[model samples]
Target chain A: MCGALLVRNPKGGLDRPIALYSTALILLLLANIFPFLTLEIGGRQEITTLFGASQAMYNAGMGELAVVVFLTSILAPALMMTSSLYVLLAVRFRKSLPGVRVLLSWIGHLEPWVMLDVFMLGVLVAFVKLGNMATMYTGNSLYAFMGLIVVFAAASSSFDTHLLWHKLGIPGRKT
Target chain B: MRARDVGLASCHTCGLLLHLPASGHTHCPRCGTPMHMRKPNSLNNTWALLIAAIIAYLPANLYPVMTVISFGKSQSDTIMSGVIYLFAHGDWPLGLIVFIASVLVPLLKMLALLYLLITVQKKSHRRRLQRTRLYRVVELVGRWSMVDIFVVALLAALVNVGAVATIEPGAGAIAFSAVVILTMFAAMNFDPRLIWDYQGEDNG
Candidate 1:
């Protein structure tokens, strides 16, 4: 279905995923380091980093919810990008990298679990809802978060799973 | 010409077309995933998960999702109440968004799944193409329901203050998340190919 769309380039190979995953990894780091948003009310400011959202839930006794938030928004995406880069690098250099097939399988399964885009919308809703009560400020991490979303989407679209499996030379059953 | 009729099976994980072994169970040689003619117990699994989600949907809507306490004033909001609050305060776009994602999507998705399950079970041949498309839509929209859960989590995390203001996640958030997860599992366990399975029966 994807190949049918637009012009198919014979040479459109590993470069897009490699570049996008690298950029995504950097953005993921930046998103974690800087404050994501700040809520100021009555001369006091509550600063929340990207991790803070889940941390606060844990603090509030919603440990399960906190874990869900963390896994979907943080860990899943990070692992996805990292593993994709690993796979792409291995494929690009034509190295017999250890566990390449397993990693590819994991990458496929992990795709649905990454919910950064949903979390981004959550951030927007939080902003508007919080806007009614307190003064809100977007931190530097917000930009990184947005950029990560775009790059993640591009990387997912450009990374063709069929092509990768074919290139890996895993033998299919003879019909 | 369905795959199963000719003893051919495709690996769901890696999309590799392969012949089914005579033993009736095998693994995908390329991706190492277990092969099945169709997802095993697709209907039963989907029914179980869909029922659980439907049960969870009650408390998810009935209970408060979050409570905002400011200056000794405490106000609790359920999913609908939160959207109404947003709309009341003129945040129409965000309210509409919450309404669609939180309220409409879940309810409609469940209904659609229920319809698909019943249709497939009854061997209804009408609109096989549309039924297949509906399953795809259900799978696609499943994740967006997490928006409300994340929104509540973010608020509970960010709006922390000692005395001036604080937000606490309510019991409903847990139930709501359960509903979302169960429905997602329900969608995944569903086999869209069952819709097309009726083709051979209708002509045979």
Candidate 2:
């Protein structure tokens, strides 16, 4: 991780993450709008959206679990992509946006909480289990969710934090 | 030599090295995060959160995480039972994943954190690199434990059929989520630099 931090501009400037983040945000929006998966049993079908999972937990009275699922899988990724895009845009435009530093720091803290990759695996496991019980059909949002995960990884890895800090005029390590 | 030995403190949020004030704490000039020579009371906070997670791990495993109600019958599955059901039903790969992320990962993370906290408290100077790596592993794997919670959420959401069949998240899901979250907090509270703080006589 530190090695990734020290290497500056290996993939050129913020253009990669900027382009990738824009793509990710669009994908995220698509993921939220469409149904994620459809469950069919005995000629009845149930469609679940991105927020449906958390809503289910909340309905089951497990509000804490609901919040956890929502925050890690949904909210965190959205916040990360949007906030990162904001910082990158601020840097690109050279506009001294208010609270960019704090937002960047918050983005750093938000990194681990973005668990779309894990949630994708969870969806797969859910698929296998659901496949046994009933017929399952993947939805448009599922594809978007998968794409968001890929593009999110690209954007996050391609983002050069050291370069941004330099551009922000923050000092680096020194004795 | 450590930064503390030279009256320097690194910003936890932005990783900038700065001079420490003679008294009291100061915010990072660049990012405004509170600056400290080390995460103040790191071990205490980690131990408290880790112990809480350990306690939560009991209910997380012992109780049912989700209940499958189908055709006038109800079946509840604990974390272990769910994995067993998957493996018994020939879903070994997914079973293996759930087993690792839900069961092995959380247990090993807490135990590893316990070990690191002990070593740091003991001021043991051996294998600092390995301990640091262990801290990284703990931090990295912390969030993956949420995979099971997510699976439970997804299952409960999609398996609703209104009297034909329904899956509801059980108490264990909440407990399990608590365990994952507490361990994450425990990992974040730990300062890996403390592992290397015993390097020299003057620093000690």
Candidate 3:
């Protein structure tokens, strides 16, 4: 009972930010699900997907790293997208969720670290490194990943989570 | 449990538990009265994760987290080298980001935890909001810290050249991942309650 956050006005409606973000999130999901990377080693061409990346890591003797990468980058984003979409669907239906205020706040807190941008950074870094070593080709998956970065960023920026609780029928929650 | 027991609290603006002497100013600087001093595991768990994250932080920074062995001579690249490589190759902005998010950010976050724990121990009163914000920043940014590792995983898979070059994550990657996870937990376990505790009141 030490500190309680107060929201003076909670009837704020969902706007462009919400719609754009929902669309972006769906795109991000497609980017991850379809293929986030491709494998082309030793002339044995194989179009490896994200799941294949996990297998690649394990083969490279980095099993733990594989799991962590899959969990946070692969799995967590999927979960976040699904959750946000569900919330948007609920909002569209004009349903009220108890404690929607707290949920939106939690989402805000979690948003900044989603890190798809960072992954893109890594991709660039890897391309540089691989370029120095050998003939490194950028795959279609990487292209999709490039698109994903924009989608993820747009999703994060355009999502005014403060308005989330409002659309959910809980007014006075945007603190 | 008695209201009278809790009534010893000083003011409304800042919660400060009033001194028993009653002669001195026990009111809060901002919001007076009953500051929440009690945190369930303020020092213990913070210290534990702080130490673990610290331990994990060393190998994370020092050693080559990802090594690409190729064609007789093996070349190992640490996170910094990878970032530098990016910068030198005309991707300075991206390099700086990876350096900051993967290297600098994680280190600062762990160090901040250490600072917070120590200050909490010393009962130092100051900049509680800033400290809390710092914690939030670290907590939120921790996931981004995995970018480098993800890159390694992605590349090691996508660009494998068989005998020419093969990428493998080294011991440093595990240690770094541990640091990231431990620091994340450290942030979580850190009761935001302590911020107000130092400011002055007892949290019920």
Q: Rank the candidates by DockQ, best first.
A: 2, 1, 3
> What lDDT score is found at residue A82 in candidate 2?
90
Model 1 residue B59 distance off true place after TM-score fit, in angstroms: 0.7
Where model 1 places Cα greater than 4 Å from the true spot, the runs are: A1-11, A171-175
Best by DockQ: 2
DockQ of each: 0.61, 0.62, 0.34
The clash tally of candidate 1 reads 0
Q: What are the per-residue Cα lDDT tens digits for candidate 3 across B1-204?
A: 422245444322222234433332342332223233233465788789889888888888788877777776677878777777778874677777788888888888878887887777776667766876766776677777877787777677765666776777777878887888788878877865465554434434
Q: Report the C-alpha lDDT of model 2 over A1-175, residue by residue, as the tens digit.
A: 2222345464758888999999999999999999999999989999999999999999999888888889988899999989999999999998989889989889888998899999998998898887778999999999999999999998999887767876787546431
Show the lowest summed lDDT stretch of 10 residues, model 1 chain B: B195-204
Worst 10 residues of 3 chain A by lDDT: A1-10
**TM-score, predicted candidate 2 vs. hidden true structure:** 0.95
| Better model by lDDT: candidate 2 vs candidate 3 | 2
Candidate with top lDDT is 2
**Each prediction's Cα lDDT score?**
0.87, 0.88, 0.64
**What pairs collide in candidate 2?**
none
